[model samples]
Target: MNDSENNLKRFGENLARIKKAKKMSYRKIAANCDLEHSDIKRYVDGKINPTLLSLLDLAKGLGIHPKELLDY
Candidate 1:
């Protein structure tokens, strides 16, 4: 994959890792982030990219800095 695509995949992997570590399901995280569960699944699956606002919401829900999600 290209660098940008690789970054997206890495970010998705990181998100999944964090989600699994927290023992949270897509529905639960979606509820916390005020997103749809399908959107969360798409994010984890790397089928879609997240917007900055969505990233911020996810970070807040995950109790992490937005940088952490992008660190990959």
Candidate 2:
């Protein structure tokens, strides 16, 4: 894959890892933020790219720093 695609995949992996580690479902995480479960799933599946604000929202929902998501 290209660098961008690889990065997205890595990010998705990291997101999934953190989510799983916290035992949080997509719906549960979404409930804590402005995002819908579908959108969060898309992010975790690496099917969509998130904006900066979306990243922040996810971090907020996950109760973590935004840097955590980028920890890949």
Candidate 3:
């Protein structure tokens, strides 16, 4: 895979891992981030990537710093 693809895959993996560890559902995260449930699912599944703003929202919803998401 290319760099972007690699980053996305890693990000998705990290996102799923963290979400599961936090015991949060896609719907709960979506509600907290004010995003669609399906959108968060897609992001966690690596079906799509996220923008900086979206990442910030996700990190905020997860009670983490935005850099934590990017650290993946």
Q: Stretches of candidate 1 above 4 Å error?
A: none
Give the per-residue lDDT digits (tens) of candidate 2, residues 1-72: 888888888899999999999999999999999999999998888889999999999999999999999989
* Each model's lDDT: 0.85, 0.94, 0.86
Q: Residue by residue across 1-72, what tens digits does model 3's lDDT show? A: 899888888999999888998999988888788678898888887889898889988987888888888776
lDDT of 1 by residue, 1-72 (tens): 887777778888999999998898888887787788898788888888999999998887787888988877
TM-score of model 1 relative to the true fold?
A: 0.89
Task: Estimate the overall C-alpha local distance difference test score of candidate 3.
Answer: 0.86
Candidate 2 lDDT trough over 10 residues, lowest sum: 1-10
Off by over 4 Å in 3: none
CA RMSD of all predictions: 1.1, 0.5, 1.0
Error of 3 at 48 (Å): 1.2
User: Candidates ranked by lDDT, best first?
Assistant: 2, 3, 1
Q: Which 10-residue span in candidate 1 carries the lowest summed lDDT?
A: 26-35
